[model samples]
Target: MATIDLTSDAFEKTVTADGIVMVDFWAEWCGPCKAFGPVYEAASEKNPDITFAKIDTEAQQEIAGALEIRSIPTLMIFRDGIQLFSQPGALPGHALDDLIDQVKAIDMDEVRAEIAKQTDEPSDAD
Candidate 1:
């Protein structure tokens, strides 16, 4: 799939709508984000099953704030509305491809169970 631009309003709906969603948080001024752009776009074409989305932090400050994006070219992945992975830095094409493989290989059932466990556990705030 081609990389789609995401606004704050569309972020939630796109993430929750289907299978895997990968978001690239970026800013036009960042050099690393520029380098990673084609790599991310290529990965999107190679893995058409996944949703590849981009958020321009400069334009979508509200969404970026909500996600607490600390750096440019931060990558986030979500599956079934559950965020699976997030990281900062520019990945080379090979590394990004490897990451895609890893994401595809994950067992969502176990992920869900872990999420439930974490939520069920008492917080220190209590």
Candidate 2:
């Protein structure tokens, strides 16, 4: 699948939907970002089921600021609207592929159970 360009308008829908999303925060001029572009694009093509988005830090400064993107080429992975992992810097294609594999390997049922446990608190009176 093709990568969608992220902006203030599309950011919410793209990141918050139910499924896996991988967002790359980058700038055109950043050398490392440029180097990682092809790898990111290839990954998106390989994983059509996962939503892949790229936010140009220069064009979408507000979004960048909101996400606290301190460095170029920051990759954040979200599953079911919740952030699962985040990292900064340029990574090789293999490393990124491995990361994706690891994320996919997560047992979502366990995660949901954990969330339910945390939120299922007893009343204070008890």
Work out the TM-score per prediction: 0.93, 0.88
lDDT, candidate 2, 23-113, per-residue tens: 9999989999999999999999999989999999999999999889999899999988878988999999999999999989998888888
TM-score winner among the candidates?
1
Candidate 2's clash total is 0
The residue pairs that clash in candidate 1, if any, are none
Alpha-carbon RMSD to native, per candidate: 1.5, 3.1
Q: List the residue pairs that clash in candidate 2.
A: none
Which digits, one per residue and each the tens of the lDDT, describe model 1 over residues 40-98? Answer: 99999999999999999999999999989999899999988888889999999999999
**lDDT score at residue 100, model 1, on the 0-100 scale:** 89
**Candidate 2 worst ten-residue window by lDDT:** 117-126
Query: Ten residues in a row with the worst lDDT in model 1?
Result: 9-18
